[model samples]
Target: MKIHQLQALVASAETGSIRAAARSLGISQAAVTRSLRELEAAEQLPLLIRAPEGISFTEYGKTLLTHARLVLNQLEHAQNDLARFRGRAEGRLSVGVTPWITLTFLAETVLLFRKRMPDIQLELFESLMAVAQPLLRAGDMDFVIGQLHPSTATQEFSCEPVLNYETAVMVRRGHPRQHCRSVHELLDQDWALNFAPDGQDALIEYLFTRHGAQIEASRIVRAQSLGTLQMLVERADMCTWCPTVLQTAPLFQGQLVALALNEKFDSRQLSIVTRRNSTLGGAARCFIECLLQVIRKHARSARKEDLALFDTLTLLV
Candidate 1:
């Protein structure tokens, strides 16, 4: 099948309608239908099942769509690489970051990268680690910043550990349960949970199950936006689990408090990940270097502040 036919098929699958796909591609609906029919005939498999709601991919159609997306991504990467070689740092860099990092670290990193590579276009997609990993593997994202659990260690991506931090129960200032000394003490309190099927949610569920504590799934207020959850906790008596990095700014500002968990949860590593076998263009390389520098600077600043705090505590003691 022709490359355009494959492109049309991918667009149709994504938009779920031939008319929508044609509009996106700036082509006629008839052309889109013809291209899709030709692609299906050549493969001897129906790619889309048009229904009243929209189009759905069959099992084989799903497989073909996956490969089609990869092929298109590779072609786009090649074009970008060629453009980069002509002494221009101009190309789109799509990066995915977890919701927590989007609020905590990504803003500064993106600002620094933009200052360095002014011509390069940057797009950010915020999602949970589970969603980001597959997109990275499919070449949909050039990089992702999120937790690297044991399961991700075997993946075909290079991960650079950036931060190791404790997870704590967070609440607004003067939260009654904040003074509790044990997990059991706060067990009855309502909790706002990130309830995604993967990442920290899965790990938290596993830990709770091991402890024979039935997770209060009903009390779980699913949140995908970190800021929204923080605000909800600030206004209400709800508590949520989050990393120390998220608490640092608010804690310093006296807007939030982090209660120490009775049993220390294992530290989660924040990592910057990229495709293992893919070659990064100059702009991408520059952005990565800038990000490393920003992380190093932040880490150094945190160490200095920690040392200062220790000195003050020692003097008081």
Candidate 2:
């Protein structure tokens, strides 16, 4: 019946304890308890069971929590819409991005956004799509810039493809196997990868099986951070499958090179996802535009690089 009651319920469900929820909401524990009790009385169901280990949701409580999340998200979206109508670009804009998408290009985009909307607060989350999805559904994030996967919840969000993300095998410049021509030749070398539920792992498995190469489990490094993976490949005799867009990074300019592998790699699409039919605020609209502009600029630079390489190959011919 009331906003505070729903907030208390959702916060407690998320934090696992009324005390923690109260602290997070910046209110007294008694106030949170009162609001939660009020919500339970209105709904006529026991939502949370309190115990020595803290509190947990009952089956009925879980159902309520789902609807509570939707209600909260709708409220925030309405607030955003109202603010936009009032001709105000003043609000917190939270965006989630995959780690691979965070680079100098993203940094520049954020910086330029700040210059244009000094009144808005920009919050950035570098997390996987699996992690970012729930937060977006809960209205904690304005939108997400990440890859679209087969497992992605298509019914809950609207997605627009931003660019095609192509990957390549990268190693430190002048590695011993740099001159190797086949995936089979590099099976003995150590490997690093960013693990996700997406196609990367399946593709890797298929590549090894198809080439009759067996990679030792001990030699395979599962890296969650892109920076860590980059350093691992740069400092050791290691190789990683990486996004070709990483070529724009100065840290990798002269230190890493994409191997001329005989096998082809799969390309995936990156997209911007927002809640379906949710109208965006001016700030959120501007942020998406900035991301598109950065991608266009990077595409232009990549095209020029490809042209130069083509000229060099022509000279050889």
Candidate 3:
């Protein structure tokens, strides 16, 4: 199919109607309609369902939209590559990042990357792998720097280990169960779970299961965002399972503390995850390099007791 036809499809999907799509693309409504009709005829499938409210994608249309997004994104990368080769620093780099990176090293990495490629626009999405996977597959995001569990680290993406750190059951200081020493002790306490209950099992749930216990359904609070989770723990007297490193963040310092539990979880690796077999643009590559350098710098300055956390600093690039 032609590039404009794919563009029309994507625009229509985003804008929700032919006229809106045409307006966004700076083309006439008739031209957008013709493109969509031609695309449907070429594919021999009905891609859109027209209605009084707006247009909606058919099953076939949803399937093709993913590929269309990838094609358009790759074209943008190619153009950016050419621009960078000509020594012009301009393009957008979208990334999905977990909270730990933002709390620790993301600011330094951004500063370093900016000094080098000052004109490249950056879009940072605070997202977990479960939320980011589809966006990465559709080319709506370039890469994700987040925790990658083995179960979800499929072959569709390349996961390069960056830092290894542990998790903790955290709560506000002086909570009733702050002195509790086991995962079992906290089963009766209220919990703030940041992940979707229907998706992959949450870390907190796994810990409870490992201890041969289960949290009651009624005692759990679903926290849709990091801020909400933190607030729930600090103000609502709810406990949460999170990266141990988060205790070092400015927002959590003194406001929250990890429970002294006897159980220890295996280290969770922070990774720079990207699509396999995809070519990263110059700006993206440079930003990754900046991240690695900042990580190495952190490793160099860390105390002796903290060196073990940075042990997996092997360059997987």
lDDT of each: 0.71, 0.75, 0.82
Residue range with the least summed lDDT across 10 consecutive positions in model 3? 308-317
Candidate 2 residue pairs that clash: none
* Model 2 quality (TM-score): 0.79
Instruction: Give the higher-TM-score candidate: 1 or 2.
Output: 1
Worst 10 residues of 1 by lDDT: 308-317
User: What is candidate 3's local distance difference test score?
Assistant: 0.82
Top-scoring candidate (lDDT)? 3
lDDT of 2 by residue, 1-317 (tens): 69898899899978889899999999999999999888888889988898989999889888878778777766775676577678765777889997756754578788778887777878999876656877887667878987655455467788877766667788888899888888888888888876554645565686676666777767777776666787789887788877765665555657777788888877766778887766666788889888777656654565765443222111100
Q: Write the per-residue lDDT of candidate 3 for residues 174-244, one digit (tens) a residue.
A: 89888899988887788887564465356545778777778777777777678888888988899888887
lDDT of 2: 0.75
Q: Please list the residue runs of candidate 2 whose C-alpha ends up more than 4 Å from where it truly belongs after superposition.
A: 13-16, 23-31, 41-46, 59-67, 99-101, 128-139, 151-157, 197-203, 210-212, 275-279, 297-317
In TM-score terms, candidate 3 sits at 0.92
TM-score of each: 0.82, 0.79, 0.92
